[model samples]
Target: MVLCAGASQPPQSSQTLLAGVGDSSRASLSSGNEGGRYELTPERRALLNTIRYAEGTWKDGEDKGYQIMYGGGQFQDLSRHPERVIVKRYTSAAAGAYQFLPKTWKGVAQELRLSSFEPRHQDQAALHLAERRGALDEIDRQGLTKDAMAKLAPEWASFPTKAGHSAYGQPVKSHQELASFYSSNLRQLRNQLGA
Candidate 1:
């Protein structure tokens, strides 16, 4: 998580602190800003939420995680992905709920044409990564199966491989814990759809 040389960051004074953004209901998926492309199915939403939970960014189940920087800091602007690197306990350019590294976000954003680091785009980026790793179909059909999680482990350090260790040697959530979280999250997302 070393900050590469010449990486860009906003001036400290210019970074506006956001107190919080409310829960999952706060951002409407039907906003039409980037319709169809970023639309999330319930399974996709649950998978992303579980990843957020594992990443320690599922802050109060709110949109707050969408604004979160690495090391538990928040950035205000949603107009673009914050490529700012932070060097608290760990040096990283990772931001948003899925904890995307700057390079990773840039590639995903470019491929998906995501204009902002808003919650929906973040969700879509996660999905795109999963899709690229060939785990999306399994998640859609089987929820968070071990095979799916294993395929995604390399893409997301918080996800465990089949042997139950992070692909990146970082800490990982247990399969049981992630499975429980995904199940509950999927049920909640489905209920929201019905409502």
Candidate 2:
């Protein structure tokens, strides 16, 4: 199985799915398959707010504040408050020890940088996703059957695709088609990342 460095294990509760919506500060959770959905409850909202505040504190370089907000064993207790899954995801993404100042912050010596660079980070994510898709396509073109492909990269079953659908489902006409898909999705995601 191909393992991503920081991919969170899929959550068990319905509330865990809400992590993908909205900005880091405010996220609305939804339920049901498609049409039927509902907003998160007040309790869930409170928990989400705590998580967001903790994230903001960490991102703003307030290490003490972040620790105070989350250090009381709260970070590891996310299962009790499933709404904090987004916070968990963010924290997990920042797990490594590399540190530098954020682009916006200057004149602060010895500041640690969080991984939120604007266009560059967005572009890198887009390129990485595109390359993965290209590799998958190459596998297919080289006569690897669906079963073989699955065996090769079992984790592909969980790889996030545009609108949560596989590229094969969308069907590619050529390499140009794949390039087009990458460009379009990259543009959309870059916009979202900026906002």
Candidate 3:
């Protein structure tokens, strides 16, 4: 149900699923988001944007935008327009730009008190996922590793991989392409952080 910002979506109708948005997001990427957990440095935000870009978007399994989120409880992409009503019967649905399943979203969304699965809430949820995977510490050190990527693979579908996957994950690209994408983005973020 995600729509690229400014794009008009199907008008809201009788279908019901997504939780209504409120000013409930506690923390966000930008500085001084009222009640936000952490203020991301420009470098960190850039890195996250790169990761989301690589991941692409999903709306009931369709690409829509760079920043996307899903709500598993309703099997809807939470990044959808607030007024956009959808009711898909997927056993599981991934939410946010990070593709978090319902169980995962519940925890993350609760902690953040997310009013909507907007990009900011999605970023916070991804940060929490990264922290759980030990990537946050490595990212802070400006050292992203294949090992770290592997450890986090079960979470992030697009983490860099070795020995070209042939044709595995969604939005398939060449191993070389993936490597270049990851390395260039990581380098840029590190430089920005002066790390």
Candidate 4:
């Protein structure tokens, strides 16, 4: 299980998942341009935030999780993917808010034209991955659906499929739990947007 910074024993599953499932970049530090053509609508924002929540990268809605490395280590550099392999119970190159593996981050960064591991770039990379998995349309049109979650399962081991299991055989959050969080998060985002 992934530990938070300064924690001795592993936190409960509800607190963090194994940093082994899924796996970004260094372009723009500005979040505004990070979205690029993909609009960061409230629905999309909530969806990305929900993914962060599942990946154990969320903390008080801030960017603290953006620097979190595998095994709860924090990387000081944000200009590019850390590409650092942290070995605890598992070996992983995953870092950033989405916990992207080295290869996965490389691929996504190339695909999305991302330049840095900044918070917004990380967010964009995750969204691009979701879109590649054919889940973005469903997420934009209907919030989080079972099929959407299933599509994202391979991209993120923390997301549950219809069977409520991690696609990568790692630990996962329940669909119901995710849906509940999504609904609440969506509402919060919509409110912020005055939508």
Candidate 5:
């Protein structure tokens, strides 16, 4: 196809044209945005709380992958992990409420800000990653599914599964426990989207 003089079509990546698809998540973000921004809600708060329980405690300067706590303490002895006390099963020595690796954090933190690595900022960064990954929309629509859980699993090790555990943890909560955690909000969240 050729463009007419002074008339042109929008540019699309040749790879996207070949695939017959654009980045639909980003497309949705642009078009279907709720007031054009993400905001905190009960569902999100509950979700973060669940992640915190899994991350265990703060170390270095982050909690779960969040810099939730402030007020300085001694520097880490030698471990790269944020916490002096270590918990394995993670693929990286990540920090914060969402356990972002140093490189990842630096990039995200810079985009978000150079100052104030507080809980709110950390939550925003985590949500930014989650939304970019397409998990937030999936969870909003499906409540929780194997696929949605899988999408979110990479971000939060303890995102639950129906099988009495999560993809990354060693059974932090029981089957009943998991159900209760989701039960209170799942219906409400699903109802919010007519899911």
Candidate 6:
């Protein structure tokens, strides 16, 4: 991985750091409240440059690879909202085609995976299936009580399964759908486990 940094002409009193690779770029600026610019300290500039370079690397593979953006900010009152992050995976093996896998959540690592199949549509279907399986794993790992899972079962039962199939289908359309699917499945799993 190559990393480079540069900047346009800095203002007489302010400094700017430019970080990027090829056609992708990011800029960081340091200025006083009065609008007087200040040069970034070497340490701060290096950090900004590193981040910019990383973003550039991802952008280089635009439409062919995965990109994730994550960060956090505070309200003026200093109460911390959980950090937010989004992951997007893109693939364009077929003409005029692309697949997108996006997930956003707080306090947990966002995961994404991509694969190429002989038929692009099948690949897309598989990706959606994997995402649903992942959600079920999360519910299990979070130690959701059996009662809570049970309470959600009836609604889960009403979800539209794939035509002629007994299991949930690809592309659950909403969080409610995913939750219901997991809840329904959990009830079955709990019984098997005698929980």
Compose the digit string of candidate 4's lDDT tens values, residues 1-195.
122222122222422221211121112211334457576666777687677778877654456779988777888899998888778766777898888887888887788888888877787788888898999999989989989999998888888778888776767887877787777776655454456
Model 5 agreement with the true structure over 1-195: per-residue lDDT tens digits: 000011111222222222111132223223343332456553554354334433432221123224321112223322222432233332344555555555666676677663444545555666677676677776566554455555665555454454545555433334343334444443443343454
Candidate 6 residue spans exceeding 4 A from truth: 1-172
Ten contiguous residues minimizing lDDT sum, candidate 2 = 95-104
Q: What value does the lDDT take at residue 184 in candidate 5?
A: 44
Model 4, position 13, has a per-residue lDDT of 43
Ranking by TM-score: 4, 1, 3, 5, 2, 6
Please provide, for model 1 over 1-195, each residue's C-alpha lDDT reduced to its tens digit, 9 standing for 90 to 100.
211111112211101111111244324333422463645666776677677777777765677778888777789998887888788755788888888888888898899888888877888888888889999989888889999989988887778889999787776777887887777666655555563
| Number of clashes recorded per candidate | 0, 1, 9, 9, 11, 3
- lDDT at 152, model 2: 25
What lDDT would candidate 5 get against the real structure? Answer: 0.42
> TM-scores for all candidates?
0.81, 0.21, 0.55, 0.82, 0.51, 0.19
Instruction: Report every candidate's CA lDDT.
Output: 0.70, 0.25, 0.45, 0.70, 0.42, 0.23
lDDT of 6 by residue, 1-195 (tens): 001111111111111121111112111112211121222222222222222222221222122212222211111211221223323231211110111212211111122122221122222232233234342233334532333223222212212233322122221122333333334333433343354
Expressed as tens digits, the lDDT of each residue in 22-58 for candidate 3 is 1222122223433456456543453454444445442
Poorest 10 consecutive residues by lDDT, candidate 5: 1-10
Q: Give model 5's TM-score versus the native structure.
A: 0.51
Model 1 clash count equals 0
Point out where model 4 deviates above 4 Å.
1-35
lDDT of 2 by residue, 25-142 (tens): 1322222111112123222222222222212222221222222221122232211111221233223222100111122112111132214332122212222332343543443234
